[model samples]
Target: MMVCRVFAIFFGNCLCLLLLLSSLADANQANIDCLKTFKSQVEDPNGYLSTWDFGNQTAQGFICKFAGVTCWHDDENRVFSIKISGFGLRGVFPQGFKLCSDLTGLDLSRNNFSGPLPSNISFLQLQHNQFTGTLPPQLAQLRRLKTFSVADNRLEGPIPKFNSAIITSESFANNLNLCGKPLDNCKMTSTNSHSKVVILAALGGFTVTAFVVGIVLGFFCSTISVEQLLFRKSRQNR
Candidate 1:
């Protein structure tokens, strides 16, 4: 009976180990699918992503060998970040990145990607791109974001109120219409117009007051000169 109990315990441990391996395999397969889908979505004009050959599925960390891909481990398929800056990649923000559940950092700067970005992004570096549209308000929710930049883009409207201290005017520079904290406040057109009107009114009032005072002084001086002339003529007649 004791021998049977030992055999049962050994079989249970093997089953548990197999289950864990299977889970890992599934996660790795998901990551592979994420990359494959991402590559299919973008336009790689420079052939930079050509090394991403999906032919070899048996090799461990094969995806990590692809250009611009960073893995959490040398021997694992878990992606940590993807830095594909200046690749001349053109496309709307790739939705395939959502499949990469482990992705933390993404740098697509200096590319020609246009259109709005995904609102649920946790990390981003998208400077010097052709991206347009207002920054999403959901970006303020990224409290864990360590680095963020969207400078030199054609984005417009009020920037999200990010709480990170690292964000400054430089982070949002050259974006023609972007405004908010770390940049000029939004809706300043009306304030500026009102200020101009007030200044013009003050100048007009000052000019009118000065002209009235000059006229009063001139009239008083003219009257005194006339009296003096009349007095001199009277003396000459005497």
Candidate 2:
């Protein structure tokens, strides 16, 4: 009975180990898919992404060797960040980057990517690009974002209010039409102007009413004083 119990314990340990390995394999596969989809969508005129070959599954951390990819470990397939600045990559924002579940830092600055940015990304360094359209309001929801910049782009409209001390006007420089906190306030709409006009008109009416009431009170008090003085003088004469 003791020998049977020992065998059961060993089997349980083996099962746990297999489960851990399986989970890691699934995560690594997702990372691989992220990179593959990103590469297929962009235009790499300079062949900067040519080293991202997926032909060898036998090699450990093969994806780590690809340019612009940063892995959590040299022998692991997990991606930590991707920085591919100045690569002249032209395309809309790559949506497949969401598959890299562990990605924390992303720097694609100085590229030719143009379009609305993805709202779900947490970190961004997309300056000097050709991206256009209003900055997505949903970006304010990324509370964990530590680094963000979209300067020198063609983007317009009210900038999202990201409540980060590190974010300042410099992070949004040269965007001709962007407005909000850390920048010029957005233009007041016609509705706001109308509200201001109504407020001023009410104040003016109140002031005119108060002035008329004051004059009436002053005239009435003067007439009462004159009557009292005349009555006293006539009583004294009698």
Candidate 3:
């Protein structure tokens, strides 16, 4: 009876451990699918992202071999970080980044990607890219963001407000049109209508002032003429 009880306990523990491993594997496979989808969207001019291969499921450790992809654990194989930089990859920022729910660090710098940054990421390094567009205001909601950088991009408009302690001017350098708290204040880009309004306002003020001044001067001269004429008439009557 004692031997039977010990065997049952050991078997139960093994079963529980297997269940846990199976769950982790499923989650990691979902993450791999996300990466595979992301790889499909980008244009790899230099064939840098061609290293992402998901063709053979029977092959072991295929997902782990992807360029710039880092897995959480050897046994679990969950995506933890991505570091793909300086490859001249060009495209709109990948939407599949959101699918990596457990992504901690990301570095896609020195590429030719042109678009807005992803909203959900925490740690990001997107420096030296040709990205154009305003910084998304939703980025402030990423409370987990600690390491952030978007330097040397073609981005414009006011820099989105972020935690000053985490982001700074160095992160925004060389972005010609970007401005805000961490950087210089954005010089309001004057539109044609705005310029016209300012000019019209100045002209209107000048015209009103000149009209009032002319009226006052004319009234003063007329009063002086009347006084002079009255004095002449009185002297002639005398």
Q: For each predicted model, how many residue pairs clash, with residues at least 3 apart or on different chains? A: 0, 0, 0
Rank candidates, TM-score, best first. Answer: 2, 1, 3
Among the numbered candidates, top TM-score falls to 2
Clashing pairs in 1: none
Considering only N, C-alpha and C atoms within 3 Å, which residue pairs clash in candidate 3? Answer: none
Model 2 scores a C-alpha lDDT of 0.93
Superposition error at 2 for model 3 (Å): 17
Residues 38-128 of candidate 3 have per-residue lDDT tens digits of 8888888888777787777545456677889887765444788889988888898888887787789999999888877665667889999
Per-residue alpha-carbon lDDT of candidate 2 for residues 86-177, written as tens digits (9 for 90 to 100): 99999999999999998999999999999988788878999999899998899998988999999999999898878899999989999868
RMSD in angstroms between candidate 1 and the native structure over all alpha carbons: 9.6
| TM-scores of the models, in the order given | 0.75, 0.78, 0.72
Clashes of 3: 0
lDDT of 1 by residue, 81-123 (tens): 9999999999888889988888899999999998997888878
**Superposed Cα deviation of residue 202, candidate 1 (Å):** 27
TM-score of 3: 0.72
